[model samples]
Target: MSKHLLCLALCFFSLKTQAQQSDFSNINFTKADAIANKYKGATLESLPILSYNLTSTLKTDVEKFRAIYRWVCANIENDYYAYLKNKKTRNKLKKDSLKLATWNAYFTQKTFKRLLKEQKTVCTGYAYLIKELANLAEIKCEILDGYGRTADVNIEELSIPNHSWNAVQLNNKWYLCDATWSSGIYDLNHYSFKYDYNDGYFLTDPNLFVKNHYPVNTKWLLTDTIIPITSFLNGPIVYPTTFKQAIVPTQPVTLHLEVKQNQEVIFLLKEGNPMDTSNITIEMTSGTYKTSVKPTINKNSDELLEVKHTFDKRGFYDFHIKLKEEYLITYTVKVEKK
Candidate 1:
């Protein structure tokens, strides 16, 4: 059998997921990598039929969804380096909005074609192509414009909205997926797209998704309470799959974080298995003062730890959660004087 068939075979029939929230944790990364390898440089028109066939073998919604999700991640080049490829045509307009809108309009149409021709695209193209191609397999999806967090930092005040991702309906609920992030990440130190498989993005829960993605329209959140953009920016920056189980940040965000400096900001964590008063310590290193503290933990209950701190200056702070004498996640916190 061809690698494509073998990948589709293994990926399609084997995935068993729970209904509470769709889990992409145990996704067939090998299959995803194989499929990506096959279509790596193939343009949109080059691989539509191939993409459809890969999904046609799968009968369930989740199966079809994963097939498409994996395929996109596999093949789509994030074009993080696209900026280096100077466009043949340049729009020298006085208004930045018009220029952005013009380019956005150009790329928004026939996205698959552009992806094929260029062999790369940004997050918008990734989202558009997913929705477009997934339609062939009869899956419902929507592209969402949003503000996204990057590399342990959340800047709520980006002058222009800088990111795009997707939401798909699964079992009557909307689940978030970021194909671009799945494709790869921009290496900040190197200034390049380091191509890799990042399956953490698929079918993420709304609460966690909200931390990185604050949709322009609140209606797309699909959560009980819509989080204001301000709160999303101020919340703790969580690394992939770390401390999510043992730590719950309160919202408006789950983390009880007030990002302003000179205020007593509270961090609340509800201890889970192996997370207890004895084994856990919340450690802090503040950037402004170039000093560190092991904050006093106030136990509100057996499961709850309310960590409090006040920043004297405006700068970045790093908070590391140590459980059982090992570091959990050193969550990034930014303190600004309001």
Candidate 2:
């Protein structure tokens, strides 16, 4: 009986995942996107009315959720200072659960007040607003807090829960998304938020999503594939452009690598859509010097992009795969004397 129950559970999980991964080739998002743009700068005071305005005209739950997600991404400004403050506080209070909980409680109230007044927020606010709006529209949604890997985060350890995203159930199937990241990017040089909506974060593939986002609750990882947190922490640094191109780093699993000078390292990226391999190049930087090198790129029959590069000099180098002149996934390697 136990073995039979186990098989039944496994079958159910497989079916649930397949249902969420349905192809939406026929679902045109033009109307849904337009509706979200139509009501730009909408107030958050009456969530029921806001939800109705966003979803009432849409026929499908996915479209309804898309509208809500898009509007939040476009309208909300990410407060970097607020995020930094929260991170500092969380890290400082990490050893004390009691103090951490108190700070979280106080910060939650403070966060919402500012969110309503200034239309600015962090990841938690984005996820919360998405959930509230979706729930009001009679769509099931949830806020998932977890570790979000980025260039700024230390790859050596998973210290604290540093980020939050959302999961919505459309047609009884769960899909993952990140409105905060989709909203825009923070320009460190200018010290301001740039409102550039990244469409890739919307209804993202679970396998690709797990590369950067690791939910605190493993069950929220919609895919059946198991990705250990250690692998995620050591993975390549992905930027917003990485998702825009629908590329996944499949080789050299870890971001930091040690290789002998003159030794060739093969890096691979799986593109969701095939592209011209000629435009791919690598930009290598060491200390104060930087140069661009066109590595030997090979496109296999399986759509896997192979970037083979050899370091001729002994030095620590920070390199990135440049796609159409824009830097994508980042990796670093230490080259020792051959």
Per-residue lDDT tens digits for candidate 1, residues 217-297, read: 877765557778777766656554332342445522433343776777666754433344555566666645445456657
Q: Per-residue lDDT of 1-338 in model 2, one digit per residue for the tens?
A: 69999888864574348333235657988998999999999988888998999999999988898889989998999999999999999999999999999999999889898998999998989999999999999998889999998887848588688899998887656788899999999999999999998877887778778888998988787767667888888888888878877777889899899999899988988887556778888898988889888899887787688899988988998988988787778999899998
What's the TM for model 2? 0.92
Q: Per-prediction TM-score, please?
A: 0.66, 0.92
CA deviation > 4 Å runs, candidate 2: 1-22
User: Which parts of model 1 are misplaced by more than 4 Å?
Assistant: 1-43, 83-96, 106-114, 151-158, 188-192, 241-248, 251-266, 269-283, 287-317, 322-338
Best by lDDT: 2
